[model samples]
Target: MIRLAILGSTGSIGESALEVVRRHPDRFRVTALSANRRIAALAAQVREFSPAVAVIADDGVGGVPDSGGATHWARGRSALVELAGRDDVDVVVNALVGAAGLGPTLLALETGKRLALANKESLVAGGSLVLAAARRGGGELIPVDSEHSAILQCMRGSGARDVARLILTASGGPFRGWSREELWDVQPSQALRHPTWDMGSKITIDSATLANKALEVIEGHFLFGIEYERIEAVVHPQSIVHSFVEFVDGSLLAQVGDPNMELPILYALTYPGRAEDGALRTFDPVASSPLTFEKVDHGAFPLYGLGTGAGARGGLAPAAFNAANEVAVEAFLGEKIRFPEMAEVVARALETAPATEPGGVKEVFEADREARRVAREVSEQLQREGSSRKG
Candidate 1:
């Protein structure tokens, strides 16, 4: 059996991963499970899976653990890193959210374990460091995102030189064709209602803004060692064609599948191999017809450009961009800032970000912290301006 350590066990991706585990008990075993704050959900998963260790990343989860089971409970964030580097687990599913996922991602790869990465922030915030960690310990970093997973499958047998370009598809978000003026009036409720695929609020907002595509582009760069120019994304409303790969010979290949996170999760678990699961195999091209694509409207969704420009700038720029976006997203959700202001917040945060590349993981984190500070300042300033306009 493949021993598994699933971080962020209570999130959207974590729940789907657990569902995959439920289907294939013989193929995979849950060695460790973790959650940020959902203590009740964590407890239920522990009871069901009976994992050897369960972790609650938030210190303020309140109350003590209920003893008497085979599972031993752990608390705080350090426990997450320990579990990732442990000798017991074969695969560390870094399904964590935001930049918090970076440390465990580094540790898992550095410890020579297979890292099934669902956390885009790990690569976006510390691409060079993550690449170095995988190299230093000979760890396998497999992407859990559907887009990256599709690219991975499409380029399975092709050499890096043979692969000419990659085309990542986006759902164009809830505001697919909304004008910039229309976007300014959109509410958080509307943004959270995604066109396809259910996800966490943060990711849903990123998808709505097309910032998620930017994060994916940066991640694909580190995962496949592809340059920014070679990787491009289009607004595919259907989301049937997950990704496209064009070879140097001008031949293009596409991985078409229904939009399901479970397929990618299962693929990450048994990579370079296939598992038999009927539920995940349901896909029909005939029923899903007239799949169309369009160019992104930069005016409406400028966050896409801001994020990719940061990726192109290299060094801590991507990290800063990710951090700023996280802060801006939080503010946007809280209704402190308007939707269109997210791009401005990220842009102003980037202006203050240190120009030097991160020397190590510590530097990467330092950049993140600083960028968040700047982003919050910008967010607050925007909030005040909104008030002034009303006054």
Candidate 2:
């Protein structure tokens, strides 16, 4: 069995991964599970999988429960990284939502475990570090994102050099054609109601702002070693076509599936191999008809361009962008700022950030830390200005 340590087991992607394990019991085993908080959910999973270890990442928040099994409890954020580097676990699925995932991701690869990565922030904030970790430890890094998974599939044994361009698809979120003026009044509730995918609140907000696509573009850059200029995103409301790859000979190939996380999740677990799972075989081009595409309106969703531009600038700019966007998304969800104001906060934070190459993970974290601080200040300033304008 391919033993797995699934971080963020209580999350949307994490739960979906457990479903995959449930479907294919002979192929995969859950050696460990973790959550930042949510003891009850983690407890429920532990009862089902009987993992040897369960970790509470934000240890002080949740009350620990009786394992009622052979499971050992681990506490604190450090436990998350420890779980990833465990010798018994063969795969580390980093399903975490934000930059906090960077620690476990680096550790997992550094320990020579295959990393099935769902956390885009891991790459967005520390792509170079992630690559170096994989190289040093000789571990495999497989992407869990639908777009990246699709690109991997389309390559079909071809190297990155043989490819000319990569085109990633977007669901257009809940605000597909919304103009910049229309987004000013958008609320968290509406943004959370994503038209295509069911995801965590933070990612759903990123989807609404098109920041998710920008993060994905940066992630694809590291995952496939593609240049930022060659990695492009388009608005595809159907969400059937995950991504496209155009070869040097101009042969464009696309991976199409129904908008479900399980297919890509399973694919990551069984790379260069196919597993039979009837539940995930939900692709019917006839039914998912009218496959359409359009250019991303940077005017409506400025975060898309800002984030992609940060990726192009290289160095720690992408790290700063991801961190600032995380703070802005949190503030927006908490009703501390309007939807459009999130872009303003990120823009201000990015402009104020220093241009520097992170010599190591410490520098990336420093960039992330400073960006978050700047983003919060910008958020507060925007709030004060809004009140003054109204008064």
Candidate 3:
């Protein structure tokens, strides 16, 4: 059995991964699981999976119930990295959201474990350091995101030098055709209603603003060793085609599947092999709707440009961009700033934050902190200006 440690076991990606494991009990075993603050959900997962250990982000005040009392319990963020690097785990699925996932990702790589990475922030914030760790520790890193997984599948036998470009598909989100004026007063509830995929609140917001695609562009750069110039994103409303790869010979290959996270999760867990199961939905072109594509309007979604620019600049720029965007998204969700101002906050943070070469995870965290601080300040300033104009 392939022993697995699934971080963020309560999240959407993690839950989907568990579903895959549930289907293939003979091929995979859950050795460890983690959650940020959802004790009830974590408890249920622990009881069902019967993992060797379970970790939670909150303090150990209200300890988890002794579900059979066979599992060891750990509390706090450090446990996530510690459990991920354990010798018993053959694969570590880093599905934890935001910058919080970087530590577990680095630790999994450092311990020479196969990393099924679903968290894009780890790459966006510390791609260099994470890659170096993998090289030093001799661990293989696999992309769990649908786009990256699709790219990997297309480039199976093809050499990287022969590749021309990586084409990533977007769902165009809920605000696909909204003008600047329409987006100014958009609420969190509206932004959360994603048209294609069911994702977490933060990621859904990012998708609405096209910022998720930008983060994926940076992630694709690090994962596939592709340059930013060769990476492109198109609005594909169907969501059937996850991504495409074009070669210098003018040949294009695409991975098409139903818009479900389970396929990618299953593929990551069972790499170099295919699982014959009826759990995942099969793609039927005849039964499905017509596929369509459109050019992304960067004018409507400026955060995409800002994020991709930071990624191309290298060093701490991508980290700053991600940090600032996270803060801005949180502020927007909390109604502290208008929806349109989220991009403005990230832009100001990127403009003000110093770009330095991050030597290690420590430096990346420092840059993230600085960017978040600047983003909050920028949001406050914008809010004050709007209030003054109203007065």
Candidate 4:
């Protein structure tokens, strides 16, 4: 059985991973679980999974080991890293969203553990550093995001030389057809109503704004060793066909399924060995009609350019883009800024912050901090201008 360390157990992806483990107990074991907050949820997960170690980002969630066994309650992101690097963990599922995921991912890779990566921010924020760790430690980094997972499956039959380009599909989100004027007036409630997938708050917002596509574009570039130009994103509303790969022979292979996170989670757990969980069902074309595709309107969703630029520019740009987007997303969710302002904040920060070659984890961290600072400053300026107009 593969001993698993789920780093964001309380989150959506982590919960789905735990669900996969629950279905097939003989195939996988939950050795460690970590969460940022939501102590109740973490505690509940601890009780159910009975992991050897349970970590919380906040100090308040300490001194509670109610589970009958000896459970270690670790706090902070450092504790997450420690849990990820433990000798007992054979696989580390880096599912935590945002920059918080980078450390645990680094630790897992440094320890030569199989990293099933769901955190797009980690790759967007510190892909160079993470990839370096994988190279140095001889660690295997597998993509857990459904689209990337689909691409991975499609690439199985051909060599890298045969692969021409990778097409990453997006659902175009809830605001896919909304006009510029319409987008500005969009509230958080509307943005949160995703058509295809159920996800965390931040990601849900990202999807609506098409910033999620930008992040994925950057992620695909890193994970596949493909250039940003070679990577393509199309607005596929159906979402049945997760992603497709084009080969030199002019054949396009697409991985289609019933849009479930469970398949990816199970694949990450068992990897080379396919589990007998009976979760990954086939894609029935008859029921799922009309897999449509369209070009992304760069004018409407400006974050597409920002995200694509980050991947193309490489180095610190991606980190800065990720940091700024995280801050902007949080601000938008808090109602501090309008929906259109999300892209505005990220773009403004990207302009001010100069790109750097990612030297190590420290370099990426520095870039991330600087970008967050820049984004906050810009956001405050926007808020102030709005107040001044009212006055």
Q: Estimate each model's TM-score.
A: 0.99, 0.98, 0.97, 0.97
lDDT of 3 by residue, 218-294 (tens): 99999999899999999998899999999999999999989999898888878878888796768799876799999
Candidate 1 versus the native: TM-score?
0.99
After superposition, the stretches of candidate 1 with alpha carbons farther than 4 Å from their true spots are none
Q: lDDT scores for all predictions? A: 0.93, 0.93, 0.91, 0.87
User: After superposing candidate 2, which stretches have Cα over 4 Å from the reference?
Assistant: 66-68
Superposed by TM-score, candidate 1 places the C-alpha of residue 212 at a distance from the truth, in angstroms, of 0.3
- The runs of at least 3 residues in candidate 3 whose Cα sits more than 4 Å from the true structure, single-residue gaps closed, are 60-63, 66-68, 388-391
State in Å the error of residue 186, model 2.
0.7
Better of 2 and 4 by lDDT: 2
Clashing pairs in 2: none
For model 3, how many clashes?
0
